[model samples]
Target: MMQVIYDPLLPWAAIWASAAGVVLIVALALWRRLPGWWLRGLAGAALLAALANPSLQDEAQTPLSDIVVLVVDESASQTLSDRAVQTARAIDEMERAIAGLENTELRVVSLGDAPGDEGTLLMTALSEAVAEEPRGRLAGAVLLTDGRLHDVDRAPDLPAPLHVLLTGHEDDWDRRLVVENAPAFAILDEEVTLTLRIEDQGQAPAGDGLVELDVAVDGGAVRQVRVPVGEDLTLPLTLTHGGTNVIQFTTPAAEGELTDRNNTAVVQINGVRDRLSVLLVSGEPHPGERTWRNLLKSDSSVDLVHFTILRPPEKQDGVPVSELSLIAFPTRELFLDKIDEFDLIIFDRYKRRGILPAIYFDNIRRYVEDGGAVLIAAGPDFASADSIYRTPLGQILPAAPTGRVIERGYLPELAPLGERHPVTAGLPDLAPPGAEGAPGWGRWFRQIDLDPRAGQVVMQGVGDRPLLVLDRVGEGRVALLGSDQAWLWSRGFEGGGPQLELLRRLAHWMMKEPELDEEALTATAEGQRMTVTRRTLADEVGELEITGPDGNVTTAPLQEVAPGRFQAEVTGPEIGLYRLSEGDQSAVIALGPAAPREFEETVASGAALEPVVARGRGGIVRLEDGVPSVRQVREGRPAAGRGWIGVTPRHAYVTSDVTVTPLVPAWLFLVLAAGLSLGAWMREGRR
Candidate 1:
């Protein structure tokens, strides 16, 4: 680096000159009275002033051109109509205009759309551009976009002036349909409220204008609701389905409408559940029958239908059918048809009787095979001659009565699997408040002893005999409870049990839902992460294979989270659907939304940023034209007119050489000092 130095004492020479002259005149007037200190002070001031020298130094320097930054907006709004076309035109013209200027260069930046509700972040782009270039070189900036900047407060401490180029037409206008407020979920058959707003921008004035709003569900128009201009309306909507229901509200496209992007809004309302249908059949009503009713009735979602065979065919009464006040059972309707409608089917203390013929028993077997669920609470009849084991269901049922019965009260205990099963798991203890000393639940006097087969043995009663056995037969599932003592769980004879939870899981498992399955594989994804789970007989899976969005394959080992289950997780590099597999089973899942709303809006327009372009002394142009030429103009010069605008440059450098000097030289100072002193002396001599 070049260096320079100078003295700060050049102006003091005049002081000493006056002091010396005073001394000479005073000495001549009062030669004997002159003070020695005054002479010494005067000499010191003059000598010190001459000792400190000031000089000029110079060095060679290479000139640098000024730098100018051109920030062009590329946000989502710019993709509308001819906005993108106009932006391209303006940039070309600006480039040509800036190229022609002397001692100037240009830096161009393009900003695209942001995710979510992010609008134009112009200030962030400008800050980034300024940081990349040398600050000293920055002459100023030219912003080519609409003035609607999302981050307006991020303006920098600029060393140069900033200009804006607006990109919109004078009469640009648009109409948009907005869904103001929507609920995430709504009850079935109940009205849900939704708020909406219809907005018109630019020259679209509010008058007697009527916006025809056509509300639709699943692509069908429900109604054409008329709304006033710039008005907010609240509409009540009712949902029919029980799952995700998509409701679309749109306004009729008016003549000469700017674009249809804002004309339609989609709102999804998930269906709510408040009730469940349950069918309960009893061999005969007993003292504990009320226990089942109370347990089911406690839930708002349960719609229980209870039926009892008061007297079997073995009981003959001397009464005519018309006078007997009893109707023949609709066995075919219950077992053959509409069996799938029931979420749970319970047979309490039930057994084979003449009331239901062999044909109905056969139909019941088919019901289970068709994915229907069945829960059997066996009494003494289960070990007696009236047992239903001899029916066609014998082939799929997981338990067989041993023709033996226990008659003593015993505590109920969960099997190893029952602790994790949703049905039997987490049952409440029967012990009441302040009664912690008592057993949890009531017990039954009798329980049938049954032999376990291929199904899972989840619970045991007296003597460790199988009390509850669950098994899947084809697509259906069956849960056999060897005792009719479930009332004991509610009665708190032993300790309270999870009567409700056990029954719920047993009921749903038979419905073939993947979530309730004991041995199954399922995969779920969010974003690019995928979770692979294996519900198997073993604690850990050997390995899992995954196919990514990019067609890459990877295998992962899984850890056991619980009994008879294994799971693994991996994140893919892409955003889309994915598939996971283990051995013969596979599952497909999605990470992100089916369609990303941000990237889907792909139209290019100029209305969003036209004003920014115009502010930079640049005009809009269409991309149809060939490559435009570059030109340079002076600062504050009109670079863009009908077809183009100019670019500016602010000289920047890593400073190479520097020189500094005083205006006057030491020799000139001394000569001028001597000349004046000589002139004073000559005047004295002439006098």
Candidate 2:
């Protein structure tokens, strides 16, 4: 509703102005003797009315029903180091404080963990709470948390007073360890580097010294390295063996460290190389010559160097040395000079022709003894009296081939123990999803009957003869594939075999891939599910023991996911590195990337809401002690002191216009003037 009032018709001020104009006009007309003086006065009065253009306006406001907003952060980080207990106390105090105020409603909202991202976003929660109710009805806002607000910058600008019920003590502190850089896998026999960073909670001491760093591979102590603290250091790792090398890097806890759980880290580097460097030495050319070369050369990454001894040491071709098509082999260059350059050394069917001096064979034997891989594809000569077995190389050869070549066809199959070896383990099945049927493989038609001197028989031939065997010399690995007819499997001799894939895995495993580790300890993370696997010769292991962010420990049973491997899935209660243990073995698996949102904004400062607080003339009160009461003060006045905070009423007002009148009509005014003048004239005449 609205109303308007004003002096419009015959206003005295307007009337006086009109009369003055008329009087001036009349005086001028009388002096000049002009006509139409009254018409000019009428024109002045008409203009005055248009200039006034007057009206009145007023409004009535429906006062707000006061409401208080309470934002609570219950994210993962809040559960850290006693933050949860503080938050619960603050919320209860706020509920009791707001209950004493009249016409006030309490709205409580709890913020939980955010997926993928970290921390409690106090500002965002407050913004949502302000939006849920009417803006005019907002009384004030209160946030309860450990001051670790990740999205603190997003704090809402509240129209009403805002306060912080800060959680945690100013003296509280914590410490954590960080593994900065860990390679997915390290190359076999090649040095790989890792970086680690250590951090202190609260204020760090001025001086810190060398820390003990231990490297464990497949649960064996390869080395114990001493490294400096604070700065990052590159730790060298030479993957001594192939397959998934579960390398655990650990640093013993210091005297006052908050927790030693984060001091250890477990990383599974999947051992692999784009290509392998193979050196194939052949005493003479044969059908298998192209087979070994083609198999290796087909892969672009595999660098193959093939050498065949066509000229015997004793009998050089009688023709002129220059006339012979074959060039003299540089025995020193291949053996003594750069033996370590190749990953694998293969000796295929060489007799006692002595192309390489006895010293060269001795070096070859030393080569295998010192961290090198050797494969022997024996032929008919392996059974002869003039076999390389008669030379210095006999010491390293796993088996002495019987001077017998069995041309009988037989399906190359794995020995009983081979079924559990990472190379041949889970074979006969292609899909790893399930072990029902891995892959169907073809058969090899020919095999060499050999006598296993000292080696594990991985494959057997007719009459249960050892067809394939493996042995270790010094730190080196050796494999003996008894026959050259392996290519028969590649040609689909018996239902298209996995010969190619099998050979590939066998070679890589011998080279030591961090992926196919037989005895390994590892951890994997995807969302909330974390998988911990322990691969060992032991038939079974106890359930995984997990220590959560809050230092709570629980054990979960592990199920056999594959042969010789035990696995368990742990749904983490909070985001941070979780400690997984069984017996003396423990692994620090990062559950999520960083601290959850609740701990992001760790400082309990009011800078985020200072500007809005000033605009509303409101002050903030900390919740560490207790929440002060809420009381309304004068507009632009303090409601509470620095210890207790609240808002003051603004004393707002609306302007209203007043209309005035003399209780006299236009005709009555004219009559009164005329009668007064007439009476004065009569009295003067009578006098």
Candidate 3:
């Protein structure tokens, strides 16, 4: 190709000034009525033109192919119904049409669902594809999706028209249950309200028809209830236990619903105790008296009600009871009236005396049998005939004390069962008094000898006697600590042990915290990865049964990470609720969200991309009718018609080589100017 180019000998500013001078000279000559004024003016114009150089450019060029982006949506929502099939067919037809156009290149970019619970990001994918290609060569962009994009604000500035081939029928619909709001943490035993509603999308059924809902907590017995469709249901939920409570709400599939993936929702509410009321009845004010008190009082969440038996009835100090500073013990109020109000009752070195009657002891036994917790920190009193175990509570007590109490120093060690028990499973070993190179913690000097009759002995003391025994009686839980020197650890006697942590776990376990369950199943999610944990008291665990958001089941064997702690991890391909179970234990953990954002709206629509399409002068055509024919359209013109989608012809090219030559020699311009001047002069002379 040859084109005129220029390498001016003077600056444009100087050239423009010379042209103005020439024009002025011509005007003055014509005003004075000079002979041959037209010829003279033409010569001056040619002189000014010589100063401004012009050249002819010849070049070798290569025509670059025009790029047409075909963005296909393979997101989770598009996989439902016939949208997947429609998308596949559209891609094939668009590819064929683009191939037929000369100098046109097809760029296919497939957009799947975002990681975890994030919805389809079709605009994000489009912006990336545009950035990778040359903007000048972009002929147009075509989207083959259902138009349920979550990142519409990230739409790219298009150089050409943008067209969309919509999938799915207009009549397709879906019924999804939405959990509008739920508290992440709720007070234990308090009612928390959950805002929920069943929504109808597209052509979904609408009416007052009842939708059956099954609500379960930690995979317990499901409570069935019927709620009207499309109405907000404020369901009252109460957390039964502390720690992570999985509350699953599920509704059976409605007739003609698109999919049941959105019909179920899982909510995890962490239950926290408002305040733990502990009634501490101390038999005497010993050195360890402040140990239990400090442990309970240091925790701001615990309300401690401590009472010490300063003087027994058998020991008379010759002081009147009314005049004494000691406050009267409210046995009737504590043992009978408000016993159930206390979460834990700790008897610190408390021996049976004339203070409480046999009926009161029976009442205490009944309290424990009815889901109450008790901790017996025995001392020398446990071996006495007046021990509380000799009363009605003895029937439920885990161990019976011998007639002797050993006062020799002994190192407390974890029993074999304790290695598997949740309470003392991972406790660090402490130095025993002054022995061993490992720097073990403290040791107790007093341990009450006892013979275990029921329950598991988790810790042992001198002569392998039960130091800590945990048992379940009726619906309640109890623990017995055979020594009173737990305070030695608090005093840092030969480097303190894990007394605080041990007591904390013991208290929480007795109170029935779900995480401290001896045998349990739980799951945690981070992005697409899910870590499944199975905690048990046995030597080994079997394979875990995992049910996905869909009804499909997958089994993965649990690997023993620690003693009695088994784990299995799997990365989910999609997002939604998952059911994990092993034998009689089960847990429901939502991998992404209760109701995934992808499934929130399953119907196909072009509303999300309408603004983007309009800005590029493109149109949306439904594939349900037929595949639109591809055609070329001019810039700024509508790129779609009834049955055709248009792609703009960019005519992009690159120059490989070029040569520049002056259009005419400088000498030639001077000769032309002189000839015209002489011709005018001869004509004037002849006239």
**Model 2 deviation from native, Cα RMSD in Å:** 8.0
lDDT of 3 by residue, 1-687 (tens): 899877778998998898888788778878977777788888887777678778889998899999999999998788888888898889889989999998999999997778766789898999999999999999999999998889999999998999999998988888888888999999999999999998778986556677799998877799999988888999998887788888888898877777888888888898999999999999998988898898889989999999998777787878988875468899899999999999999999999889888898888889999999999999999999989999997888899998789988777878889988999988754343554423375778999999999999999988777899999999999899988898888887767787888888998888888888898988888887889989988888789998887679999999999998999998876677778899888887777776688888888999988999999889999999989999998888889999999999998899999989899998888998899789768866787
Better of 1 and 3 by TM-score: 3
Candidate 2 residue 336 C-alpha distance from true site, Å: 3.2
- Stretches off by above 4 angstroms in model 1 are 1-67, 70-276, 316-333, 336-343, 409-411, 416-446, 462-464, 523-530, 601-608, 619-630, 634-637, 641-645, 649-687
Q: Rank the candidates by TM-score, best first.
A: 3, 2, 1
Which stretches of model 3 miss by more than 4 angstroms? Answer: 20-37, 59-62, 206-208, 314-317, 429-439, 677-687
Query: Which is superior by lDDT, 2 or 3?
Result: 3
- Candidate 2 stretches with Cα past 4 Å from truth are 1-65, 76-88, 153-157, 171-276, 315-317, 321-326, 357-359, 430-441, 453-455, 533-558, 561-566, 574-588, 593-618, 633-641, 647-687
lDDT of 2 by residue, 17-93 (tens): 86677578657855764444444444444444433433454445444447778888786556655567777777776
lDDT of all predictions: 0.66, 0.67, 0.87
In model 1, which range of ten residues has the least summed lDDT?
A: 593-602
- Candidate 3 versus the native: TM-score? 0.93
> Model 1, range 616-635, lDDT digits (tens) per residue?
55545434443334455566
